[model samples]
Target: MSVWDELVGQEPVVQTLQRAVEDAASMTHAWLFTGPPGSGRSNAALSFAAALQCEEGGCGHCRSCTTARAGSHPDITVIRTDGLSIGTDVAREYVRKAALRPALGRRQVLVVEDADRLTDQAANALLKAVEEPSAYTVWMLCAPAMEDVIVTIRSRCRPVLLRTPSAEAIAGLLVERDGVEPELAGAMAAASQGHIGRARGLARDPQARERRRRILALPAGLGTLGDCLAAAQSIHEEAGERSAAIADAADERELDDLKQSWGVEERGRRPTGYAGSLSSLEKDQKRRRTRLTRDAIDGVLLDLLSFCRDVVVAQQAPRAALVNADVAESVRSAAGVWTVESTVARIDAIVEARESLTANAAPLLVLERMMMEFLPR
Candidate 1:
């Protein structure tokens, strides 16, 4: 299995990068990889990095390829952040590392997996490094869309766009790579609506599948105001739970690091600046928790949008293959109840909710407003 094999449904991108790897002249010093969530933008960037380091151009069995893929290569540095923003300090550190010569590989590779999350200061710091990179250095930045990156930074890098894989392609990969049964794989692919990671999760985890099922069932259950409010509360609670789980471990780790930095024991005298440091850490934790909560809620909104989209499609073209095909009957029923305009309105409501969440609106309140919009008159 070569490195390219893991990048499902990106044959054209693979070919282009493979050519670049074989011909150094075709390779650029900086690259921007843009794709939707679960479309493997980061995977593509990392695969290219591995190929650049490998003597045989990403031969999966090679030592360089294995180490790069495992994220242990001496000359490869990947930055991924769990927080809301990547600060100037981290970006400067990456820039400093990028100036060094390769320790083991032929070229040093720097990858930023969440370039979209870089603060303005951080982006500026990175921009300088990208503008005048070392001869043997390469930078790869991945984001959800080209527009997510600053225009100045984006214009300097070669852009690689990855499309969402087709359902057939996603299902095939699930069967081939993950050993999922074909029947289950197809269902998951349809449910995931071209998200490869989401399909894999749904296929492998019964809990994930059940959660999706409940979410998908929501559209058909908004028959009354009471039902709509109940649905909203349920989704809000689910988002809270998911966000807490995602942030709790990271929060604990940050607290531990702060404690170690202050040389403070469980019941010891407080050191100088300890209170200030603890306050700063708490502020960062709060920001992270808020961001995680919004992200979790946004995921639920996207799923709701997909379901609404299927209803609109069913209304317009009754014979079309729906994304949520398992719920075809419910979708058809929804199409009957909601005119095309109303279905579109529901989608708009979901988008508005997402925007509100990004604006730091209360999550439960935003969800409640959206659910009320879904209620029948």
Candidate 2:
């Protein structure tokens, strides 16, 4: 299948990019792709990159198309970062690479997956490259929103906006691509609230689904102060556990690779730059751990916000469909105790918590404050 197939419910975006690929004058040196989380911003950028490199404008079968889609093309560099922020060093390296002529493909494609994560220095470094790119170079930057990117850099690039796919579209993709049962896919789609990656995770992993269920059930149990505190603690601990698991795996892999590269079985022999490499890796891991922890906390807050939103919806339109339909009874119970204003306040609290997390506030403290807001007066 063509690379565009993976972009669910983005037909307009696909058409625009396809036309650009076919017409040299329509294509620009720099592109900024903006969308909400799971709206396929990165996927759209990658697809466009593939099309630009493909002999037949993303004929899926071509070597250039396949390699670009797989992120192994000689001329396509896809930066999928796991760190909290993209540093100036990384941006400079990408810029250096972008200045080179195409090795194999028709154009040198540079796709930065999380442009929103770029620090000011990094953004400035990237801006210089985009401002004066080589004739055969193409830059594609992905961010959650236009505001996340600096105005000077964003204004120089062509903008492509992607919308969150509908639940029906998400469910259809799950059923078609993942072989998921229709009923389960539909439920996961509804629960994901338009997040494509989250829907796939909920559909594929029972543990993820159970965790979401527990998170959704938390609001119904927040009758007492103790219950609210306990809920906060549970979410905090879960985020810690998830972050730890990811960090552990990454640490092991990095150490293993270092050991192999140095030809040292144990800790005896040390190659040149070994200590520096290890130190740099550890520092990066620490940053990544922090980002992962905040991401987990933000995910819980999103789930909680959805639950509160469902309560508000239930109160306003009793027959309206709920995001957490499986927990309809708990949602209805919450709706009984919370008025529209109170529910909206609870949602505001959750949003505040999300912002605090983004600002690097302590996750536990932010969560605790948020949970207390949910406690019944």
TM-score of each: 0.95, 0.92
Residue-by-residue lDDT tens digits, candidate 2, 219-264: 7677787887788888889888999999999889988998788786
Off by over 4 Å in 2: 256-278
- Model 1 earns a TM-score of 0.95
Worst 10-residue lDDT window, candidate 1? 290-299
- Report how far residue 177 has shifted in candidate 1, in Å: 0.5
- RMSD to truth, every model: 1.7, 2.2
How many backbone collisions does model 1 have? Answer: 0
Clash totals for all models, in order?
Answer: 0, 0
Q: In lDDT terms, how accurate is model 2? A: 0.89
lDDT of 1 at 189: 93
Model 1: residues >4 Å from true position, as ranges?
none
